[model samples]
Target: MLDNLPLLLNGFSLAVSPYNIMLMMVGVFLGILVGVLPGLGAPNGVTLLMPLTFGMNPVSAIILLTSMYWGALYGGSTTSILFNIPGEPSSVATTFDGHPMAKAGRATEALTTAFVASGFGALFGVVVVTILSSWATRFALRFSPVEYFSVFMLAFGSFVAFGGGSPIKALVSLGLGFSWASIGMDTVSGSMRLTYGFNELSRGINLLVVVIGLYGIAELCQTMQASPGTVQPVATRLSPREVLRAVLAMPRYWIALLRSACIGVWMGITPGGPTAATFMSYGVGRRFSKAGARFGTGEPQGLVSSETADQAAGSAAMLPMLALGLPSSATAAVLLGGLMIWGLTPGPALFAERPDFVWGLIASMYVSNAVCVIMALTTVPLFAAVLRAPFNITGPLIVIVCLVGAWTVGSNRTDIAMVLAFGAVGYFMSRLDYPVAPLVLAMVLGDRTEDAFRQSMILAKGSIWIFWSNPLAGTIITVALLCFALPGFTALWRLARRQFLPPPVASGR
Candidate 1:
């Protein structure tokens, strides 16, 4: 870690240049707007602005883009808290309790806590990226096809097993996502399986379109049906005393903060990304907290858990992309494309050959985290006022944004239709109390899982034992199986204990 300090200093010098600093500020502002608006997220924001950076130096362009990513992560929680609408997929878990807190007249406290936690998480993740990235890159080199498959399997199993819903429903949702992900043309066989003769379907469904419909359109539908107003007006200001109390309470959950950051780093280095990390951290917080029974009922721990993990994972994802040339998330994939366009190849050689660009990107993340957190905290009351507007006004605006975003992403009329269909599906799923997150996560992981499994099978001549042929792969597969069975085993153990133990007799007073 210390050996990299000179490179980090050099990177900081580049990032702090006047032109780069101005670009970073602009990117942060735009990212917040994109994140606050429904259907626009980090990937879309970066993609929209990428062409503008083609004429700039590689370091400057990266500084701008990564700053935007940090701002988006911070901005997403605002909509989730005020409107029960997750502007980004990573913020979905925030809505579970953030909206509740806002309705209960604790909007200021909730927003403050989210920003503080996000800052802490981002700082930790950036430090990891700076110091331990080389080690992480080396570790990732040990992964082969079977090992990669096991890692993805572990993510899927952990999410479904601990998703806090009906196991059957979670499995069904995941299966449906897998089905949707499989609709695209197969790269290995060069044949389509589920396109059903539709040329558009041959390209498969876009996860971005699905996210917009499921969260944006479906939320508007539910808000309209459940109440006339989208959200109730509440006190959106925090006093000095109230702010101090909230800040003081944070230290009590230090264990949760540390644990969530670790989980986020692991997920980011692997393929789980911030969405999965947020849910996993929330689940862990719910199960481990003393107030476990009150998890989703305006719990502050829920906000901290989700926000910390989301920010940490979002920042940490850049590590693998920078060090190993592997994109851990969709946004990272877009950034990877940008890197190639700029004639920069990401790998171990990146550190030796282009330390300036790599360190500049890392330094920018640290700077952006501080800037965005302060910006988000100051603007909380302003955004909270949007909740006072009538749903009748906000609802149609949301639908229009969704339509425009979907249409413009690929310029395809079929994507607009797909959004509407998904919106209806999301509504019904919510009405049935089914978890929607697993479906989205499964869609993200499904294609990668299939590719890894197929590659492993081909290498092993169709022998399943290849997953256990090496110690590392075997251990990963073992852990994945355990994660899958843990919930069932715990249930069966409880049942057995109940059946064998005698009930306590009530004594008459």
Candidate 2:
């Protein structure tokens, strides 16, 4: 970690250039707009902008996207506090206390607390990434095809076990992603696999097109269906004095802040995603804080707990994506796709081959966090006004953007139709309560998973036992199996306990 300081410094020099800084500001502003608007979150915003990055340098493209993400996160809190709406799904927990505080005329305090806490959490997560990424990359250097396969299984298993959704639904999503990924010619054999002689599918489905459909178009449809008339934002003025007061008072809740940040880091690394991290941190805060009883009644700590965890998890998730080719969230999955599009492979080799890119991205996170905090605090009113735009106007515009983005991917008309098809699929999947992140992750990693498994099989002469041929591979596979089985085991245990335990006698009212 100490040895990497020089690289980090060099990264700062690269990130702080005039061009990069301009991009950062622009990305953050657009991201805030995306977050403030109904139906557009960080993932959707990033997906929408991906096409524009095709002509950009890979490093610049990544910095722009990541800065947008941080800004979107901060923007989400604005709506949660002022409009009783969560602009981003991860900000849902913020609404509990944030809205109440706004209603009580503490909007400025709630907004300030949320942004500052989020900044702190993001910085904490970035620090952890800086220290852990090098070690993780080194550890991954020892992995072979068998180990890689096991690692992929572990990622899939962890998603199923801890994804905070139904295991069957998650598995089904994975299957769908893998099926879509298999569409087109096989790279190793140079033979068609899933294309049913459709000339359009010979090149396979584009990841960008799918993402535009799933996140952009699909979300617009849902938003239109669930339009809630005009939003009346809370009236509040943020003064420098109030901002300073909120920042100073944050130290009082240091324990909660630290605890939530740690939870965010752990969840981000393990694929629980920021949405889960926020709720988990909020729940834990409510359970343990002395003001637990007042949690939903305008407690400032509630905002801190949820907002901090949301940003922390978001920042920490980059580690797995960069070091091990594992994306812990939907946005990370999209970024992984961007890396591949730029001819960059994510893994230990990436660090060795392109330390500049890796460290530059890491350093940019620090700079972006500070930029987001300042932007969010100063521009709350501007973003709040944006929410007043009717969905009828914004909805159609979003659809056009999605279509245009899809069309540009290969200038193929078929891509537009595919986007519509996937849009329907995504909408229905959301209605059925199916998790989309797992599917997205699977799609991004599916081809690699298959290649690794095939290589492992070849090495073992078609023996299935090859996964367990060595201690490292065996251990990883074992852990993956345990992760996959954990939910079932817990359910069975609960069922057994319910059947065997005696019921308590009813008390008289």
lDDT (C-alpha) at residue 231 in model 2: 66
Candidate 1 accuracy as TM-score: 0.76
lDDT of 2 by residue, 34-135 (tens): 888776778778877887897999889999999998988988899889988888889999999999999998888999999999999999999999999889
RMSD of 2: 2.4
Q: Report each candidate's C-alpha RMSD, comma-separated, in the order given.
A: 5.5, 2.4
Q: Which lDDT values do the candidates have, in the order given?
A: 0.78, 0.89
* Model 2, residue 220: C-alpha shift (Å): 1.8
Runs of candidate 2 exceeding 4 Å displacement: 501-509
Best-performing candidate as measured by TM-score: 2
> Against the hidden true structure, what lDDT does model 2 obtain?
0.89
Model 1 C-alpha lDDT per residue in residues 266-362, reported as the tens digit of each score? 7787656788899999999899877667889998888888989998998888887776565665577667767877899776677767878888888
